[model samples]
Target: MTKAMLLLKFAGLEFSEDRGGYHKAPKGKLPFIDDEGLMVADSTSSVFT
Candidate 1:
C-alpha cells in the first residue's frame, strides 16, 4: 500500500487516504481510488485509468 501511494503521488493525482477503507474495497485491498463515482482497485489499473 505504501508503494501504491508513492506511485500515485509520483503521478501527481490528488487522493485522500481512507484509513481502514481497505475492508470496503472490491477485494479487500488497499490503495483503491474513489474518483467521482468510480472505484478502481489495484495500482496497475488505477494508473492506467
Candidate 2:
C-alpha cells in the first residue's frame, strides 16, 4: 500500500488516512484521500485518489 500511496503522491495529490469514524479504515489499514476529497481503501482505489 505504501508503494501505491507513493504513486499518488507523485501525482501531486493528497492522501489522508481517515480517522474517528466507521468510514475510516482499521488502524493498520490506511484510508487515503485526494485533493478533491475522494476517499480510497487499498491500492485498488488509488486510481480515484
Candidate 3:
C-alpha cells in the first residue's frame, strides 16, 4: 500500500486514502483508482492504463 501511494505521488495524481474501504474495490483489493468513473484495480493494471 505504501508503495502504491508513493508511485501515485511520483506520478502527481491526486487521491484520497480510503480507510477500511477495500470491500468497495474491485477484487476486494487495496490501491484501486476511481478515476473520473473508471475503476482500475491494482498497481500493475493502473500503470498500464
Cα RMSD, model 3:
1.7
TM-score of each: 0.65, 0.36, 0.71
Best by lDDT: 3
Q: Which candidate is the best by TM-score?
A: 3
Residue 6 error, candidate 2, Å: 0.5
Tens digits of lDDT, candidate 1, 3-46? 67888788797767878766778777776777786877777887
> Could you give me the TM-score of model 2 versus the true structure?
0.36
- Per-residue accuracy of model 2 over 1-49 as CA lDDT, tens digit each: 5776678688886656434655454334555443455444566656653
For model 3 the TM-score comes to: 0.71
Error (Å) of candidate 2 at residue 18 is: 6.7
Residue 2 displacement (Å), model 1: 2.4
- Candidate 2 minimal-lDDT segment of 10 residues: 26-35
In model 3, the Cα lDDT at residue 9 comes to: 92
* Model 3, runs deviating above 4 Å: none
Kindly report which residue stretches of model 2 are placed more than 4 angstroms away from their true locations once superposed.
15-23, 26-28, 34-38
The clash tally of candidate 1 reads: 0
